[model samples]
Target: MTVDNLPLIELPIIDFGPYLDPSSTAEQRQAVDHAIDKACRHLGIFYLVNHGIPQELCDKMSVIARQFFSLPFEEKRKHKVGGEVRGYWFTTNAEDLSNIPCEGIAFHPPVNQCSNGVAPDIDPASPEARLPTTHDALGGQHSWPNDHFRAHAEELLSHIVPLKVRLLDSISNCLGLSDASRKLVQNTVPHIAFNSYSSLTKAQMEEGVSNLVEHTDPGTITILTQDVDVVALQVKDSDGKWCGVKPIPGSFVVNVGSSLNRFTGNQYVDTLHRVIHCSEKSRISMALLADPVFDVVIEPLPECPFKTDLAKFVPKTFGAFYLDQVPEDH
Candidate 1:
């Protein structure tokens, strides 16, 4: 269905430019507050603009993504999961094949060790099981055809990670939590996966052969950067009907995930969304998942009063719940 035909809700668009000013204007703070309220009350989704990230950087990242995914299957396979930490992955390979409920392993441990005397867990037998890969170096040493892209990817990561923290803090203030409560999530390391949806032809879109399946992101927040003209992303509304989201240039789609739901005591919405192929032209988008570190404890903000069962509302570590949801290969 077209974006207009479905029962989809429009989220807010927050501009961070004014907030970045040294002498912040009254209107700026009000704008931020308005955006915060919209995110908390309505769908926990919004389009971010003037976020300080350069257009050149965004363009370059998109180029790298398209180039990497366009590599020959054999070439792309060279970057496969030789170890758990970094590499490339094919579509659908991220599915957990051992959990009863069935889910995908979207988070990967940081490449470095944490300060709490905790070592990042590594799986020798199944490197693929540890995290999503981009290249296919199954049994070989991991390598990249273009090393320059690695630098760009890391740069993007550096900027985005901190931005996520700032956004989380805004969320905390909206909930009226103290600074200490906000810092509770400061050390929460995010496992990011840079995803690119390939441009599919009409036949492929009609056949539904290449698009992602219906599922909710399993993290605190999922930020996406998609092509401007493509029209294939869809979200299921409260009425159980699929609605399309129109592409707004220089705009990114943010969806609240399960982790955020737990952290906020269910004040935000973590709705179901998926991508469908369009016959008009090919499409590409980058999806970054920001999740808490595996060991960090998740609990509802104490200030949020709710009549619902506290046990149900209390948060749980993502790793504990994510591991249990791994699906089995039939």
Candidate 2:
């Protein structure tokens, strides 16, 4: 579809800064929660302005990313992802997302890394001990970039990770969750990735080639930042239409993911979305997928509307749940 024919329903934007402020009044926080509850149930994708991430840090991330992507083939390959998938992985056409040629670097901080989402000191006979997972391979170690990507990446994480926590708290409030369940955020293993896409030729665009195959993310939520003035993102509205996600200055595009839909008893939509093929400018986005650690079962909360219209919530462990959601071979 051309830009003009896009649906009239624009993805809503919420200035979450005040709501996330620790000193904000309950009314202020509740108002933001009301808006978020509506967005989660309907749009599932929205722009979060004043989300506390500094614009200067975002700009620095972009510059460092561009510099690294411009490096010589040999230099960029030095930290390539091999067996662990923890480093730079450059490819022409990715098997998972068609028409999008991109490179990605994965990072999983060890602070929150655990098979059962707890420290090793917990008693062995406890239920958490029985749930140790095999997917711990994706965390623990990371490849450092030789081209000054380390400093900026670290700083970005320091800022973005806590932002994820605040956003999660806001969402929990929207769901009317109690304090005990809200504390469940500690079990989340945040996986952050830096992605850059190559531009496609006009012929490819005309031939119906796509930037990314349509699919919902597998985690609880995805916080994204893209290069300014380059609009390649799209989200499927409730009516089965593809609509563009316009870049907003100093904002992050946060979307509900599948795990969250299950957690909320499908009250929120884990919206299907994809990157559009760009014929002009380059595409770069940093995404942090705040995922529940393995073995933590993500099921519907006790107060899920539990309507017949939604999918049945299952008490599926995060490890098995996320693996089954991986996009199948094209």
Candidate 3:
């Protein structure tokens, strides 16, 4: 028999240790896979604990994000990466999105810029080494505030990219897709966002003004690390009620995005979520958005157990789907 959706009244916290362990039995790994599949189908989101990313690395990421966002707007904008997709972006309350002011910096994986998809020559001293031509939408120069920030950020990517690959492999197994599906996104560049949101006033909070508007992610999946002390993130549950995703120390939030939902033939819900300004203190989060390679055709695989004859989504390349769905301002 196939699996059923899990209850979505509360956010599910999944222990990923078993899947991460080489000595784990088949049943142990399968249990984790089922839990992930259930969470994605019913709530589209869950918290992952004991996922093998070091606490020191998480702490370092949090510290560096806070330190960089704390800088003055003028100083921060100086390093703007400048594109619809990458670099620094600061929006005024009137410019819209949430219709509230916010600050963020985006970076793509190093492979995006390097032709070989590995080992980019980003030596600071070699100014001419930076690629003059971008490979695709995923390829671009990543501007940074300083050498220190770049080092840590790149280090985080080195760890998290592998995590993304491993997680995708598990998801493929859950959906009964071939092992080849695990590498469907191997060439894609995942975008990393370091976001900062300021606390709103009592009047604004009372007005139900969201710091980020409700929307589904357009990519395949998102793995997010947020401030442990904050409680502003919320996800729309199966019943349509918004549920808060409370911060868990040393954990990351993983959610299905629209592309993955389509790939799974709508079996996995594309999560609708937003951030509200409820805290007196400001909040910061680091999110890694993973997508398939731009040229990937997004039709459901025949091996996917959830795929039906009357497919709900039309076939399209990942690049085309992204352009059609995502706003350029973002």
Candidate of highest lDDT = 3
lDDT of 2 by residue, 1-330 (tens): 444455434778998967557898898888888887888889788888988789999888887787776676567667664534366775545554333366666666542223633456667878655324433534435777854788788889888888888788888877777776776643476777887777766655567656666788878899999877866788877677787777888889889988888877787889898776464666778888888876578877676666444446667777677657642321
TM-score of each: 0.76, 0.85, 0.84
Please provide, for model 1 over 1-330, each residue's C-alpha lDDT reduced to its tens digit, 9 standing for 90 to 100: 223244445657788666556698877766686686577456667788766667677778877766766566567656665443345555545332221111111224433222222433667365434333323211233355476776786687777777777677667666777777777645555654455454444544455443566777667787777777756778766567777777777767878877777767777777677776543444566666776665456667677555356877545565555444433221
Could you arrange the candidates by lDDT from highest to lowest?
3, 2, 1
> What is the alpha-carbon RMSD of candidate 1 to the true structure?
7.4
What TM-score does structure 2 among the candidates reach?
0.85
> Model 2, residue 319: displacement in angstroms?
1.1
| Clash count of each predicted structure | 18, 0, 0
- Candidate 1 vs. true structure, TM-score: 0.76
* Model 3: how far residue 249 lies from native, Å: 1.0
| lDDT measured at residue 312 in model 3 versus the true structure, 0 to 100 | 67
- Clashing residue pairs in candidate 3 are none
Instruction: List residue ranges in candidate 3 displaced over 4 A.
Output: 1-9, 92-100, 110-140, 185-187, 206-208, 305-312
- lDDT (Cα, 0-100) at 104 in candidate 2: 63
* Model 2 stretches with alpha carbons more than 4 Å out: 1-9, 20-23, 83-85, 91-100, 110-119, 122-135, 308-312, 327-330
Q: Model 3 compared with the native: what TM-score?
A: 0.84
lDDT per prediction? 0.60, 0.72, 0.75
